[model samples]
Structures are given as structure tokens and as C-alpha cells.
Target: MRLFSQLIALSRSRQLGRQFKEIERCIKALPRQARARLGIQTLREIGQASRMEFPHLYGTAPEARYLPWGQGTEIGYARALSDNPEVALRGIALWLAVAYHETKDCTHAALQAQHRQLLRVVRELKESHRGGDPVQEWMNTGAAA
Candidate 1:
């Protein structure tokens, strides 16, 4: 009985550690400029995007809660700075990492490939424009692509 209790406590501790690590990774993944651009409305939009793109990655219907937190909440927050190419790139990387960590399946590999393509597009956009509203640029180009 004591051994079982210890095991349960250890499991909970590991789960909590993973959650905290993911949170930290999300924060560290985005740059200062990207963080400045992100807002609640944008985050909601990203959440919507996550919902559309990978609903199955999260919980069941209705709430569709994301593991370690709510559905897309972490990714949405991390990816909110869509205007910043670095942010967008890092966000996808984080997403891929999380997906791989969670499932280690073909889906993870597929997303990895898809996001890699997206990173290239973002890099191109970043290089093309010298200085302007990144948000506007993303809306005009990144969002479409």
C-alpha cells in the first residue's frame, strides 16, 4: 500500500513537472517583439485556428480540453505573434515538439513537415519586407499561405 501511494505521488509530480516545463517553453519560445504584438483577440484567433487544424490533438468534444491545459491555449499563446516570423516559426516548432512528446506518431512527423514548409514561407516574408506592420504583413501574406 505504501509503495502504491509513493508511485501515485511520483506520477503526479512528473505530470506537474511536465506542465510547468511546457509553460516555460511556451514563454521562452516567443521573442520580445512577438510578445509585444500578441493580444487577447489575436490569441483567440489562434485558438480558433488550433481548433480547426488539430482538434483531435486535444481533448474530446465540447470542452476539447488540451492536455496539460485547455485546448490550444498554450499553442495559441505561443503562436499569437503570427506577425513575427521568428515567433511564428518558434511557435510551430514548439507545437511539433509537444505533439511529438505526446504521441511520437506519424501525425507528429506530418505536422513537423508541414510546419517546416510554413517556416520557409515566413522566412521569405521576413526577408522581403524591411520595416512595416508585421501584423498587417502576416494578415496579407502569412495567414493566406
Candidate 2:
């Protein structure tokens, strides 16, 4: 019985890991799409390293949020792009998924407001992406400043 219980625990842990990876996958996918949209082949293509960030891995939260040079969609626009076979938006989708996940999390009751903000960000992200070329917008934004 003890062996069986250990096996069950192991299985459950693997399952949870898989679930987390799936969510992480979604978040990671968006940056790839954004990278393509930005036309980056290498870090040097992004210009001076001081100003631009090399595309970081998806799970790295601080780096994942921004496009090169601190620009890119910050809203939930991924739902729209994710539908596109090309030019997908994976991050915003996870932002919402994270929010939805939070809704079901054990900490849900305590973090209701934070979850709501995440949902709002997703909605705004989609709207923001709908406007003029996001790529151009990001590049143009704050360039003069």
C-alpha cells in the first residue's frame, strides 16, 4: 500500500508539471511570434544591447514582457493573433489564462482584484494590437525621447 501511494504521488507530481508546462508553452509562444514580427535574426539585429533586449526565454518573467527596446503589446491581444496561422500572440493569451487559473487557485479569494486586473490587461492588449502596425508602433514609440 505504501508503494502504491508513492507511485500515485509521483504520477500526480508529473501531471502537475505537465499542466504547468502547457501554460508556460503558451506564454513562451507569444515571444517567438513577436520576435518574428520584429524581424530579428540575431541579437545584433536589434541594435545596441544597451537599448535593446535580446529575446529572452519565455519562463523568464522580467524579460518576456517587453519587445526589443522595451516595446511590444502589453495587452491581451494574443487571442486575435493566436487565431492567425501566422503572427500569433502567445503571451496575452497566457496573461488571461494565468488570470483564469488564478480564479481557480487556492489563493483565488485573496487575489480576486489582481486576477481582475490581469483579465483587463488581456482585453486591452487585444484592443491595442488591433491598431496600426504593432511592429511599427513599438519601434516608433519613445524612439524620439
Candidate 3:
């Protein structure tokens, strides 16, 4: 099993009292292997509403970019969510290789570093999303019509 060093998120929210809890919950629900692949040795997020800071996780879309805390590591959220996750050169390459169906069974997977693309396209489709569907989608779609 491989893992990155520890990461901690400390926040002060205007309402809930535990801001990064959503992100924490989502990450915590991962399988041991998934969590290990995520690479953070420890994910400690204390918050109230939703702001957060995560290491190694990159966001590749507008929907992925909403977490309002940048304790330092912010490459790009639109890359992938953990369920769909991101890893910059490494992650994007890995995500493409592991992409959707196989993300759960990454045991003994090997990736050569040169596979990253100059242009990456991420389509944020909703497949039985855990949280309620983002109302923004409705508004955006409706507004576009």
C-alpha cells in the first residue's frame, strides 16, 4: 500500500461549525485502497459549511472548483473528483487510465509518466450523485434555454 503524508484542514465557517465535513465525508467513504491511492496519510478537515483545503486532489471543472479554501495546494479541481478524481500529470494520466469503471480496483497498476495530454476534456456527468443534484445545473440549463 502506498500513501502520501498527512493533510489537515482547519476552518472557521459562518454557519455549520464544520465547514469541510462534506469533503471529509466523501473522502472517508473511500475504500482502503482508494484512500491509499488518494495518497494523503491523514485527512483531517474541521469546518462548518463547505470551504476546504485538500492536498493532491485536483479539481477539473466549475462544479469541482467550489471549495473556497486554499491552504496552499490548488492545482485544478476540474481534473477529477476522487470517485472520478484528479492527479495533475500523474492523476490525469491515471484517471484516464483508470477513468470511470476501473477506479475502484487499482491494485498493481503501473502508469508511464509520458501519457499526459496537452489538452484534456472532462465532462462532468452526474451518475447517481451522492449529494442532491446541484440546482445550479437546472438554473444553468434553464437559463441557457
Reference-based TM-score of each model: 0.25, 0.26, 0.24
Q: Please, what are the lDDT tens digits per residue for candidate 1 over residues 1-145? A: 8677556545534543454355445545656444434223233333443655453343224455544333433563356346676566555444433332333222334334434543443343345334468788778885668
lDDT of 2 by residue, 1-145 (tens): 8677556545533433444344345544555445343222212222222242332112225645553212222232343245663333343332334333423232323344444544454444344444677687778779745
Give the C-alpha lDDT of model 1. Answer: 0.44
Cα deviation in Å at residue 6, candidate 2? 28
Candidate numbers sorted by lDDT from highest down: 1, 2, 3
Which TM-score value belongs to model 3?
0.24
Give candidate 3's error at residue 136 in angstroms.
Answer: 49
For model 3, the local distance difference test gives 0.28
Task: Give the 10-residue window scoring lowest on summed lDDT in candidate 1.
Answer: 99-108
- Per-model lDDT: 0.44, 0.39, 0.28
Which residue runs of candidate 2 sit more than 4 Å off their true CA positions?
A: 1-92, 104-109, 133-145
Across 1-145, the per-residue lDDT of candidate 3 in tens digits comes to 1242111111112111232233334445655455444432111111111132332222234455544432222222223333454333233232322222112222322211111111111111112222244686666665758
lDDT of 1 at 122: 38
Off by over 4 Å in 1: 1-13, 37-59, 62-145
